[model samples]
Target: MKLQDQPPLHLTYGLSIHPDETWPELWASIQEKALAVRARVAPGKAFGLGLRLRDAVSREMAEGGNLRRFRQFLDENGLYIFTLNGFPYGRFHGGRVKEQVYAPDWRTEARLDYTRRLADLLAVLLPDGVAGSISTVPGSFKPWIHGASDVERITDQLARAVAHLAGLKEKTGREIHLGLEPEPGCLFETPDELIRFMQEWMWPRGRVRVARELGCSLAAAEQKVRLHLGVCLDTCHVAVCFEDPEEALRQYQAAGLRISKIQLSAALEADAVGRAALARFIEPVYLHQVVADLGGGRLRSWLDLPEALAALGSLPEARAVRVHFHIPLHFEGGGGLRSTTFALRPSFFRALQNGATEHLEIETYSFDALPGGASRDVVESVAGEYRWVLQRLVRAN
Candidate 1:
């Protein structure tokens, strides 16, 4: 499966973990922060970077020989990039990002242009014969997709991206693919929804569009689209929706979908007793979708965490609640609240060890905003997560 890109299962850190600053300043921040994390985590080995870039930074990096300079930097250090978090179009933190993070969603030409720029940058940055992956938003927020035309527009835009990627591969030998990352409140949050969208919209119409655009046969276009487009299986997001990771991976594979990358994160969980403690997490930066277990194999979902807390009084009797907050993988209970790390069972690690995907990115957003988390060091925290995950992976093997 071309897993030799960044060997040893290709584990990397999401620069988004330090989400407070980006662009201009972030350009320098990345060089320093990446070196810092590498020194603490894997001082003696080559470090893998799961980079994040927004439209503005991407534009800057594309010009002025910046791409070449960054490549030189990586080559000088024992560092390499295998994956990118392209989900956030701009400004992921330090303000009210809430649902606006999904803006300029897959339907807009802006999104398409931004993605192509990233591909160009990655084409130069990737190592020889190493495949690259970019994880993007899941079409759009679920509420934003109103009708068939919206779906059509999103599909058409994505097809254009696939065609661009195909052309890039033709010119450059780098094989970079785009992955649609499904979040709890996004368009393809559930397995059935993702399957239906791919089978109905992408497979039938999107491929035809790609074929026409690329001036290739339907079969050739289909192969290119499937090869370049797939799902970014996020562990915390699936857990937030009360879905099993191993089973979810099985469903995706059974549906003939590729696991572009696996984002390693842990969600927050608490029962009714701890509902009040959850108030501490009420922030304006990110959307925390909540899923309530209504018992008898039933689940009720809220688009945001605050909404779930507000409706908890009127909702049916519940057993536990899982929040979309991407807590640190090593996080445990505190004042009645706990982590969903348990969801990442031994089977999950086993599946990963068996080459479910070549890209493994440890991802958690704005965890420093949590209580007591602010006091912890970002490098140490991320290093701790790497240690924890690597231990489990070794045990599973």
Candidate 2:
């Protein structure tokens, strides 16, 4: 599928390497791992690389050179710079890597300073033509979504950040696109709220807000500031809100806002008594099916999983069949069989064949937040899972 009016073939899928793996040794290991991954994909299907930054400042300091090297790594490895992670913000100095807001006063001067600094760093490392995703900026949290900041202050914060980003664009001569992700707990939670913010306040050319009313469109009220913001589709975040994945895609697509990124991850499906009961547990409400091509040599052969397994035959071209998978780890403990884990369903595999989505990014970064000791193993597990899916895709197509 084409996005940003770009060619469809520019589509690709990338892996987000955890921030913990940013060090030299781990970074090298990740390169080796990713190399193995690249060797498996078809010749012309473009792919990319995603770098997750834990603490922007710390990464700038400790891994600055490493960062540069990583960019070179991307080139050497045939991967494009996909995303620069900005989440669980805070320090990663020692044990207990904390997630804190450096800007406790998001409405005041602190937030601007932080934003400027971050924009500055990102501009340097991420030049222009780079697409970025911003999640849970300090003021974006809980009560904030419920009428949190006064109009003047929120507007100011947004202005400064936007200005800084714009300034970076001029300096770099690159059209860096920012996807203002509407997360579940942030101030700009829903698509409606975010879209309204963009249309009303931010992008109106000249708009300035003096009063922040519950439903007042910022642009209608102000003439000094205009927002140039767009949307970032985090499937898991949307899924948790019980929104239909396909419907969400269509809505945003209709809105004319960029689909910054389509985060591919499984949503949890519940173990229930029936279909209705089970429906409540689907995190994304719906998930994309994994499509692959088996050795049968064809352009692309589409087939459902169980049926394909049963009707094994040779093909004229090498193509892939898609399969659906759900996310959010599910486990059970009872009946004298206490255990914790996830379940893979074949039907989930059947669903992906419905769309023409070209680019997809594997976003299983939540594993980074797992209990302390499990980081490495968890990352490896995710890698293995992706490889398994890729193998199946290869076989089916």
Candidate 3:
């Protein structure tokens, strides 16, 4: 079948690359950066936007007729929003984000409120007949959630979010899904953990809750949970955990889970020779969780790059280390530090070929943290990533 005949995968890049937390800054970015990028890469074609709105900005967009105005801007500029990066709730850049990025995780009412607001905004912004996705935190930070009660509390909160989504679908008929994006050192970091959550927590408790709320049978409620709650597969996070993308995707599919959105990104990989070279990646802005593979299937994981670097020499059996760093999609490796690009590309293309999801977002949100990135033009960089992915998709087709 021809590419146009198949279901169209909405290709776009996340707006998080621009460190704008307020509405004015965000609107300026759309006009100055987002529009310019679209003009260069897509020209007259309708460009999709993977919007990243913090809690404050989300509230701002929903009020004062901002949503209507923004929709008008999208129509005039040939743009539309298909997905949102709801993972980060507060300021993502210009500060030390560290483990705090996962604060107000699925355990709290605040997370639920924030996500509900995002869904409300997305429902208004999404064009007719197009489904939308909002990628959120993977429960809470693993270390913080101690025991059975913690798990139950977090799961209950998440169920509330899922129930809210079901209500939105019933009310708006837009079918917006919440994608729990898994990352290293967080709850449900790997595919297996995510699957287990679905079977143990989500399916059991969520089905009953949804059934009661929607007044449907258990089977129908189960189906609703499957449709609304899904995974946002971040290529960089999967690669850093040394997961085979094809196998992971297969596992998610087998579990009746939907792939909400594919976050197209690359991670930093290093062997012993290149181990010392990764020191340059030690930045203060975000937490760079590093997973070191020891022989005999043992993996040593650290909370941050500094911890990993400090113990690099002690782990003599360490063969390779993958850091949670979002690098440009087009660049493979540099400065003796390799990227998991090779592993990511084939798997991403495989998913594309199989129609894994409708949304494909290039999410290299760490451009400013990259070496010599301060001088780089954000608009051109975003446009370049879009062009690179577009070319790859065409070739894959």
lDDT against the true structure, per candidate, is 0.85, 0.43, 0.86
Task: Candidate 2: list runs displaced more than 4 Å.
Answer: 1-29, 39-47, 56-70, 91-139, 144-148, 204-228, 271-359, 368-397
List candidate 1 segments past 4 Å from native: 1-8, 19-24
lDDT of 1 by residue, 1-397 (tens): 1223333368887888775244556656566676777777677687888888988888887888878888898888877888888888888767788899998899998999999999988998898867899999999998988999999999999999999999999999889998888888899997778888999988888999999998999999989888999999998988988998888899998998878999999889988788888888888788889998999999999988788889987864978899988888898787668998888888889888777888889898767667676788877788788888888987876
How would you encode candidate 3's per-residue C-alpha lDDT over 237-309 as one tens digit per residue?
Answer: 9988989776778889898888998888889999888898888888999999999999888899999998899
State in Å the error of residue 250, model 2. Answer: 2.7
Give a tens-digit lDDT track for model 2, residues 1-397. Answer: 1122333312233333334433453365456655555555433433455544444443453444755665576566556644444443543323342113323434657555654554455555542354444432524544443352454466556655655555565567543344555554455646776666656545552133222422245554332222223455655555544445556666766766655555555443222112123222222211222223444433221222233323333432323222232232322323222111122223322223223232345666444332242345543455455565454434433
| Best-fitting candidate, scored by lDDT | 3
**390: Cα error in model 3, Å:** 2.1
- Among all windows of ten consecutive residues in candidate 2, which has the lowest summed lDDT? 335-344
Candidate 3 regions off by >4 Å? 1-5, 345-348
